[model samples]
Target: MSSPLPLVFDAPKRGLPPRHLADLTLAERTEAVAALGEKPFRAKQLSRHYFARLNVDPAQMTDIPAAARERLATELMPQLLTEVRSVECDDGATRKTLWRAHDGTLLESVLMRYPDRATLCISSQAGCGMACPFCATGQGGLQRNLSTAEIVDQVRSAAAVMRDGVLPGPDGKPAPGRLSNVVFMGMGEPLANYKRVVAAVRRITDPTPSGLGISQRSVTVSTVGLAPAIRKLADEGLQVRLAVSLHTPDDELRDTLVPVNNRWSIDEVLQAAKYYIDRTSRRVSIEYALIRDVNDQPWRADLLAKRLREHLGYLVHVNVIPLNPTPGSKWDASPKDVEREFVRRVNEGGVTCTVRDTRGQEIAAACGQLAAEN
Candidate 1:
């Protein structure tokens, strides 16, 4: 294995702007309200407006007394994300929003509409520390981990977008729907921002007015093979799906492709994944980005299947993603023939594998591309 990387470079820059309602648990919010000289129940009211009603405007909160409403809103509903710009493609069904944080940090989140459901891809950190060469976000390096509120508000905003019928439907007309799936596959390695990401997940899956009320099963958290973090997440008692970005089956290529691989080998990562499956009884997702003539060989596919079968057996699935080449990147998606053959080999080796339906390519949908371009 490569020598362990120095720890100084990867430690997240701590802290966020003033606390917001989404940043606190119910008990914390109650204490915050009391500290501001308001009754404890006012916290519940604020949570209902921000979470269930998805309204942050004090004026819209008619249930609260007018005087206290403004103070409460001003104190706990601080705007965390400002829209820098939004770009859309797939006939406006896919929208990517670039947001500027209070500290001038830039991050991107994508809301994609499909026939059966709407999925929002959220960022856990401002930029990625994983340093995956093919990813645009990793190119910029990690700026800072997002606050829990910063992460939760993305889902809330996207939920309102879906609820209010902003995106067009199958008939190419606006139709209201519920945002169903939330994927932590944008801009950052979620496990690198572990504490806030876990808190955000709770705020997302908890029942409203405590949270956005999205089901735990609908949430997916992806990491670039953070082995210890994977097992740590399993112990949290959450059923959210775990996705490992195992770009290659072999460590030689993976260490270059996913720099984090040097810290935790494939065996260690798979062993951690098996622990997650054993804990949650949910199938762990093995994410593989198929770069042309690189990590796309039939032998690699067979080896990936064999390793997965050996470690995880029926508790894992492979998601073969076509490489979304970043600007001026040497990496590109494999030819259809090569991708198809790769999938066939993995399936033949006894693990289920499927090519992901990639979207928003025309609009630079790959993770940090939009934020980087803007």
Candidate 2:
């Protein structure tokens, strides 16, 4: 057996912005407003404006009194993300935004509109510390963990965009739609910033006038096999889906592909995932990124299926992602035939497997590609 690798979760040292409405609970927001020499009810009013109406500008907050609106906005709703640029593809159904944080940190979010539902992939941290050699964001290293509000605001902004019919549809015109799904498969390892990410999840799923009112079932949080954190999240009593980025199943290759595997091997990660399933009763998503000449061998697929069947049985599904190659990287997506056979072998091994739909590939929308260029 390999010795457990040391885990060093380091976030860049930086001052986060002052308190924002999304950062606080209703009770906390009430206290914050009271601290600003205002009545407690004012907090509810502000929450309604931000969370329900998705309006942040003081000038647009008609419900609040003219005298108090500016002060309230200034104190509680300070601007968090300034859009640096937006790129679109897939007949404008997919859009990616590069946002500059208040402290000038750069992060990105991708909004992908499908025929049935619109999904937004938002970042929990500016860059990643996972150190996966093939990932663009991981190659950059961690900048900082985004504040709770910073994380929630990305969804709020994307939701507002969908509601207002800003992005074009397959018809090549502005087609109004609703933001239906939110995935944390963006720039960082979400569970690494446990508290803030959990708080953001609450702010996302809680009912309107308190949160965006998106159903908890509509959210998916992905991790790179953080065993202890996965168990911790299961205990949170959330129905949100759990996705483990098991790039490879065998310990030897996984230790190189997902360095955290050295700390908690494949068996440990699978055990943790099973714990999550037992607690949440929701099927876990095993995310496998297939890279040519890397971890895409049919034998590995069979091994993955055998292990998953032993641990999770039918309580798990595999999403095989074709590697979205970064610039100048030797790693690339596997051949179409190889990908199909790999999926076939996994299914033959008694675990269901399917290819994940690759979206926004042209615009660098997949996982860590965006942060790599910026």
Q: Give the best candidate by TM-score.
A: 1
The TM-score, computed over Cα atoms with residue i paired to residue i, of candidate 2 is: 0.97
- lDDT of model 1, residue 168: 90
Q: When superposed on Cα atoms, how far off is each prediction in RMSD?
A: 1.2, 1.3
Any runs in candidate 2 off by more than 4 Å, and if so which? 1-8, 170-172
Worst 10 residues of 1 by lDDT: 6-15
Task: Assess each prediction's global lDDT (C-alpha) against the native.
Answer: 0.92, 0.91
Tens digit of per-residue lDDT, candidate 2, span 181-230: 99999888999999999999999999988899899999999999999999
Residue by residue across 1-374, what tens digits does model 1's lDDT show?
78986432344655587889999998999999999999899999999999999987889899999999999988999989999999999999999999999989899999999988999999998888788889998888888889999999999999999999999987889999999999999988899889999999999999998899999999999999889999999999998999999989998998889888889999999999999999999999999999999999999999999999999998889999998898899989999999999999999999999999999999999988988887
